[model samples]
Target: MKALRKIAAQAGVALEEVPEPSAPQGTDVIVEVEAAGICGSDLHVDDWTPGYEFMVPLLPLTLGHEFAGRIVAVGPDVEHVKVGDRVTVMPSAPCNACPACRAGDSEKCQNKQTLGLRRDGGFAPRVTARASGCLPLPDAVDYELAALTEPLGVGATAVRVGGVGQGDRVVVLGPGTIGQALAIFARLSGATDVAVVGFDDAPRLETCRALGFDQVYDLKEPGAMDRLKSDFGGCDVVFEATGKAVSITDGLALLRMEGVFVMAGIHEEDARFPATDFVRRRLQIRASHGARGPEWRRVLAAMAKEPEIFRKMITHRLPLDEAVRGFGLAHERGASKVMILPGQG
Candidate 1:
């Protein structure tokens, strides 16, 4: 079987003819992957970005974290899920011996190994995942939409952290998949108005518009920022999902005094912002990363309830043989969410 892998401590991923995975081990399940999404973090790994040095020792690992599939085999200890179950696997696993895991807070596990990053993951037709990380899918959601749970979970966490509420106006500082997810959840959280912003991102910005966000902007356009300010100034909450430090200044400028600003993106460098103004405004800054177990269930339920709405996030699809091309499309920002169908030719 061929799998997409980061074979070295440098740029680019390779498709290698690797042997099929052995049978499942303790508490693990072997899933026949149906759909996998190419994420920004995957691009980071492919480009050999600065923050991913921890993966240096874990090179040659298969590179996909956001995926959903059916379990072909299950370990002896697995009970909650069984073979033939369609599920989306959470990429992160915690060592149960950690204090946080012992307290039922696995999200804070002192020793955590992410499946796609630290271990082999679902970039191929089959991959092994811990049974605990797998969530059974609802009848309404299929494999492609189910694959979106990870990124959507990320957006859901950002909105919850920002505390978006009824009648609140919210601004999202990126038009990528996560940013789109933030906008969707903000509306679901009862925010009456939501604005999404992008920089020379017509494709993704158009995707935002397609997702029902009317106030979409491309900063490259003349007077676009002015128009955004006129329309959404003094907003109640702002979400920075661009991963660019400079967006902090722009997002804060639109926020009302004491309004919440949530940082949901993974930055590659340090961010510098105005100190005096932030102090005077009494603004609050919050950080949102991966979602917890309950948050995952919530995101999955939302997708199940309105699967078509979430399905729009997927704009491109490719077979496993062409998975590298999918990576390129994602890196160039030419596609919103590219699905890699390992089972498709």
Candidate 2:
């Protein structure tokens, strides 16, 4: 199996020939890799030490988690999915016996095996999965969008955690894929005015206008914060998807009285905030972790129904061989989602 691994710190990923894994024991499935997405966090793999599954493989680990593949084979005990079934792996195979799993917080399972990060992930010809990790996709959804389910799940989880609701005003502080997904979910929650904060993507915003976010602001524009306050009463809920310390502070500054701020970005390190704002307005601040199985499935269903959003979100697609180029392009100005197919695109 030719797999890409994080071979060196802060260096480009390297391709390697690794042994093909065996079939899962008891109840499991083996999926033939199709499309895998390179996530922003995966770029941070240079310094990231896997916390939950640290004992699992680390360096030289296969470097993709978000993917949709075909069920080439399944263990005898598997019943939910069949060979040749088109499916998307949840990217998480949790220990269902753990307390968090029993409580429906599978992301917090005491013993978790997060694909890509913990196990040999999807950046190969094949990845062995627990039958539970595969979510069969409807024919309406294509493989590229299927690989995007992971990032959209992150936004959906943030919406759930932030408690954004109908008639409320919301602002998403970033124009990246996660911010775009968060904006879509905010609109779904009935936010009267959902402002996507950035102008880098005039085109993405124009497409978003088609999806129905009324107010779009470019933070790069002078006095943008004032414009936001005038239009949306200072934002009932502000979400920080940029992961920049400055942007988090900017989000805090824009929050209305008693407003909540959800940090949806994965900042690699500590960031300082204005404690005075907390003292003055009693602001509620919280950070959202990646969603678990149920949230992930909802994101897939939503994408299936609205291909329009996926169309606007996915900007670039390349073959696995071009992954390094794809990663470099992901952060380029005006980029949205960059997807990588394991084989020919």
Candidate 3:
């Protein structure tokens, strides 16, 4: 099988031939990769300058977490699914008996492991993951869209954590892949005045416009905050997807009294923001990590009902061999959802 793997002591990945994996000794299954979505997580994988990226895989690591593939084989203990079933791989493989999992918040599972982060991932012709982390996809969903099921779950989790609803005026900061996914999910969650604020005055704003945001701002100009304040008598909910400190501060200021503020960005360092602002406004600060396995199913169901609008969000699709081009495009604000077709396209 051909797999994209990062060799030991390097910061790059190459497509190479590798042996197929069989069912794990534990209750795990091996799936043949169909489509894998490159994500913000991949950037962290490529960041070699970092203070340990938490859990860098033992070298020759395959890349990808957000993927959908066919279950080729399953271990004897696997009960929920079997061979021939299509499943969207959940990015995080939680330790089921941990405190977080016992508390019904598996996203924060203590001994959690991830598919792409530590072990081989779906950026291969075939990959293996714990069967419990697999979210079964509907027969009607296309492989490209099925690959997006994980991101859509992040959006669903954000809305739940952010408390967005019918009358809420929401301001979403950043226009990256996750931010755009956040916007679509916010709209579906019944937010009426949905706005997107992007750092650059360029193609991302265009994508925000096309995504049908109620208002789109090229925040590069001065007086951007004043305009954001004018839109709502201060916004009701702010989803901060930009990792920058300024974006976080701006998102905090945009909140209406008693409004919810959701932080979804993975910032590299601590951000300084007005602590008094939350106190003065009586705001609710909630941080949303991406969703767990069942949440992925909700996202898939949402995608199934709204294919026309949801599918259009995929702006680029490339073969796994063109990984660099795909990664560059997805990292840029210019591209929307980008996916890698692992096999025949």
Candidate 4:
């Protein structure tokens, strides 16, 4: 089987022939990956960025985390899921020996192993996944939309963290897939005004507009910041989804007094903001990482209900062989939500 793998600690991923997964072991199941999405983190890893150095020991691993497919085989202990079931796998796996896991609160597992990051994951025709992390997908949710469940769950979780409600004004910094997800869920959460901003991100900003976000801004354009300030200044909530350190201060500027600011991106550098301004405004900063069980359910239900809306996020599709090219496109911000169909070839 050919797989996209991070072969070393240095930059770049390679398309290499690797052995197919063996028979299921313990609670694992064999998933024939139909669709997988290239994420920003994948770009970071491909670029050998700073934050993902933890993956150094896990080099030469298959690279893909957000994916959906049908189960081909299952271990004897896998009772909840079975063969031929369509499902999406949650990439984060908890070590059973961890204290949090022993207490049955796996969500707080201090030593969690992420698929595609800490171990081999779905970027091939088939991959092995734990049955516990598999969520059954509704028949209406096709493989393409199902592949989006993870990132969508991430966005839904951020919206929940921000406590966005009816009539609230929301600003999302960065018009990438995660930023798009933030904008979508904010509207779903009943926020009347939602703005998505991007810096030199024309393609993605246009994507935000196509998704029905009228208030889209390109910080590179003249007076774009002034216009954004006029429309969304002192907004009820502001979300930093750019992963850029400067977005913290930029997003804080749009927040109202006592408004919540959610950090939904994985930053590679420390962010410094004005302490006096933040304190005087009574601002609150909250961090939202991967989604929990509740967010997964909400995102899955939403995707099933309106597959087309979510489908719009996918701008490019490629087979496993062209995955490197797909990564390039995503890295250049020329595409949003590139879906890698491993089964296509």
Question: Which candidate's lDDT is highest?
Answer: 1
- After TM-score superposition, the amount by which residue 196's alpha carbon in candidate 3 deviates from its true location, in angstroms, is 0.8
Q: Which of 1 and 3 is the better model by lDDT?
A: 1
- lDDT (Cα, tens digit) per residue for candidate 3, span 150-259: 87788778888887788778888877767878888788878788888887746877766776874887777787767777885478888988777787777777777898
Q: How do the residues 239-334 of candidate 1 rate in per-residue lDDT, one tens digit apiece?
A: 999999999999999989999999988898799888899999999999998887888899989988989999889999999999998898888876
- lDDT (10s digit) by residue, model 2, range 256-337: 8889999987665679988987779989998897778788778888887887667667778888777778777875655567
Question: 221 in model 3: Cα distance from truth in Å?
Answer: 3.8
Q: Tell me how far candidate 3 lies from the true structure as C-alpha RMSD in angstroms.
A: 2.4
Clash pairs for candidate 2: none
In candidate 1, residue 99 scores what lDDT? 92
Winner of 2 and 3 under TM-score = 3
What are the TM-scores, per candidate, against the unseen true structure?
0.97, 0.88, 0.91, 0.98
Candidate 3 runs further than 4 Å off? 8-10, 23-26, 49-52, 96-107
Clashes of each: 0, 0, 0, 0
Candidate 4 lDDT over residue span 1-345, tens digit each = 999999999999999999989999989999999999999999999999888878887788999999999999999899999999999999899988888999999889977888888889889999999998999998789998999989999999999999999999999998998999999999999999999999998888888988999899999999999999999998999999998999998889888899999999888888999999999999999999999878888999988888888888999999999999989888887799999999996
Candidate 4: residue 288 lDDT (0-100): 93
lDDT of 2 at 318: 80
Indicate the worst ten consecutive residues by lDDT in candidate 4.
51-60
Q: Is candidate 1 or candidate 3 better by TM-score?
A: 1
